[model samples]
Target: MSKRIDPDNRRRYFIVGSVILEIVTPVFRQRLEKDYKSKGVGCLQDFINSKPVIHILFHLRHTNIKCCVDSTNCRNRRKLPLNYSQWDLLYTENPGPPKHHCHCLYTTNNVKLDDLDVTLASLILLNCCNLTPNEEISIKELREFKNNYLSHNIKGAITEKEYQTLWNDLMTYVLQLDPSKQDDFIRIQNRPLDDSLCNKYFVCLLDIHKKLEEISDKLESSTAEILTAINGQSNMELLTKLEEILQYVRCQSPKEKTDNHGIKQQTPIQPYKLGQPIVTLHHQINLTSVVNTSWKVTDISMMDDGRLVMCLPVQSRLLICNTDGSQVESIHVQGYPWYAAAVNNSTVAVTLWGIKCIEMYDINNKLKLKFISLPGIMRLDSGITAINNKIVVGGENRLHIIDYQTGKVIQTITTKCNPGRLHGSGDRILYCDNINSNKMYWYSYTNARHHNLTLPSPPWDMTILQNGSLYVVCKDGSVQHVSSDGKQYKPVKTLQTTPGCDGIHYNLTQRKLMTIQNKNRLVTVYNEI
Candidate 1:
């Protein structure tokens, strides 16, 4: 037997629709306006008002019907996509769940209209409702107006009595919602919510507003102290706290930073033509034979003063070498050092394979300062690079940018695949993915855009030059000279060693190509041919 449309079903549909129309629409409008403005478009209100409301209405109505249908079909077949992750399955399934899936918020099945009174208002204002919090509602008057049944149900199936109650509540809330209050509007938008995947987003958002007000009182008195700590070198804890605040502010009120000088103008993505090497190799310097490491060189970094830093993975040792095929100083670290990068004249940043932290070391003093902890990070096999005092550490599907001095994570950049070796030059960070079938990615910090380049044989390690050209080592014993844009590539040279070809580096000052032959235990340096 087909399920009867009950009063409870009608109530849920009405409340959900009312919440979306009153609360959610403004949030969507604000987001759309900001997105348009960032892309250098204008006429914000016109664009927002002209957005197809019919689609939203239809979508909500469809979702409501789906929920009711699914509830009825629950005895016949289990409703699969009732949770948040399976929201995509809604359109595909015959009797789908609601689009929002806000049923989890309410404890009871029979929620009275009076119970949701404060919640409705709070949700609207918090979700950036274009309504004043102080706007009063004439409950008695609205109840009377609702009894008259001003609007008919879209389905025309629900009884007039049931439809009137839903309509009355919706109309009352809509009338009271006024967005003209500047102070309330600013407060609702600026506060940052706890965005962990486990926590309920709406609950966290409300809690953050309360917490921020308390924090605001303390910050006013300690303004100078807080500022000094944020700027200090050893204040890692303070830096992390400040970075959290910075992240919130940037997300809430993101304004495009325009450069009037045009010094940092974006380079047009030119069609890459693969040909001969711009710089050829003259001779090879065998440095790996001196350092008796059984394993491969996972990472390599060249310092400003022409010293080379290389990390051996299984050996757990960092070898410091000069221009000649000689080791300067070799030191052992705690965990399996997967990657290393020269941060400054005296310091180097090292990330481990099994560890969730990046260790910053004072090489001259021979002491470890502090570890920069990466929260919820995993599968960090190798890629590490330093660009503008920030070290970009690669994990499974994201590149984490950490401040070298402060040990604070500045930003997390998502990727298409797991990153392997990283190379930074000027404003660009180039990295090759472990997956994606030998594809290289060029990420621009200036424009915050990523472009992909196809490569032959999965690239093990890569080095980007000052002019944006790349020298990449392949797993199939090939070293290719790839174009800046990565549209084309040419095999400049081929390594003799097969299974051990890994970790490529280019010394800027000396203009030499350095690569590791892991099985043969050799670090080969080739002078330009």
Candidate 2:
């Protein structure tokens, strides 16, 4: 026999689980209806009633379909190019005599809004529906809350304080989707949860867990197939294929500063090729309108996932946004944020102006991880970058490389000029002087060699492409491109802004260039022609 659960703890679980099933699930269904209607369909119910299995499969190609077919002989089955394993929960599974049946089987089962739960509703909203950035964020948060807080509580217990915190967070997400649901949440929270009601909620929670486990099993099978394919390669092809596999595996897991050997892994540099001289504006956003403030953007950096992190010095905050300029979240720091860098996919390190400290944040969780103070009281720290397992910071005419894990200074290098903004690739670090010098410098850690290249104007900030080339923004409203060797330079694009550009970042995967006009409070994105 299983141990009995505490009544209070069971009540806590019941409240959270009930809110998701009763309040959140209906909102997701409504949104799905709205989305389908907007896409030329009359309504979700009508669409399911009229459309055939082929049409449904096409519409839901974005979902996971691994379980729909036999894995041992998957190739023999008539499978669509994408996943749709969650189809049975939403539709009837009648193994048709004509496998590609055109009859509308979904409506025959009379699947209603009540049949949909939080997990299935969330997956449909995220994968099938076209959502605005805010809607996307809300749905993702609700899904995470279910997984982390509700379903994973093996003890079925939650402290009073934790219950309140979780309740508030869930309420915030629910309100974002439908403000009218506020009263529904409050009623569920205060309602008396008896054994019968709690057991019902417990069953719902178990259903969600089962669905999640199915998805996880499918992913594990897919990963195993990939490894098997890699093993079947010839010796000559194995080396190249192994490197590509490693890169893919790294992308799947949480990004780390160092590998298992405690050695820094250099990002593989792609071959350099000059792009066409033509520059086309892809998107632009006014920072003032988004934040409702005229505060200037101090610096900007791009995460591995393509989100933009911008420093707002006057507000002492970091404004995070999607690549299309939709606001994601805002983070407040302890001091004035001068420069920001993506430490990894989920973490960002920011340098504080007039302070000798660097703060690291987990942007995904919206929590501050820790603070690292320099050894001495060297204020005015400006430039910052993360390479491998270390952080490089610029302060007072010198640079300090610190281990990110221990916050210990590993090495310090003296410089002739105070570095303003830093960017690193492989063993080299590129920076511009803070004294308004018309020169850019590149330092190599391997040989301890420093090389300087004179530019047409004072350099403000810089970003490096995957091919090892550099794009430096200058004070004269001109953007300069330098060869990997730091020997050749030319103007790539010149903006006619009054104060020139203050920050620049290159997205190697997307092949887009993002620049910040701090004085104008504008952000412009450009595509390579």
After superposition on all CA atoms, what RMSD does each candidate show versus the true structure?
25.5, 20.6
**Worst 10-residue lDDT window, candidate 1:** 194-203
| Candidate 1 local lDDT, 449-477, one digit each (tens) | 88887777887778865345787777777
CA lDDT, every prediction? Answer: 0.52, 0.67
Clashes of each: 8, 6
Give the runs in model 1 whose Cα sits over 4 Å from its true position. Answer: 1-293, 379-382, 494-500
Q: Each model's TM-score, in the order given? A: 0.47, 0.51
Q: Please, what are the lDDT tens digits per residue for candidate 2 over residues 1-529?
A: 0136567777788778777766777789899888777877764555555433334443444333332323232222254433444465455655655544332323334465556677767866775667989899999999888878766555555678888777777888889989877756655566554333344355346433343334332333454454454333455433433333333333222222444434443443344444325346877877676666557888888775456798987887888876667645788887898888888655898888898888999765567998998744246757888876588888677788888779888888887677877987667788877567898987876567788999889888888765567888888887887887788877774444566787888764445678888767788987644
Q: What is the alpha-carbon lDDT of model 2 when measured against the actual structure?
A: 0.67
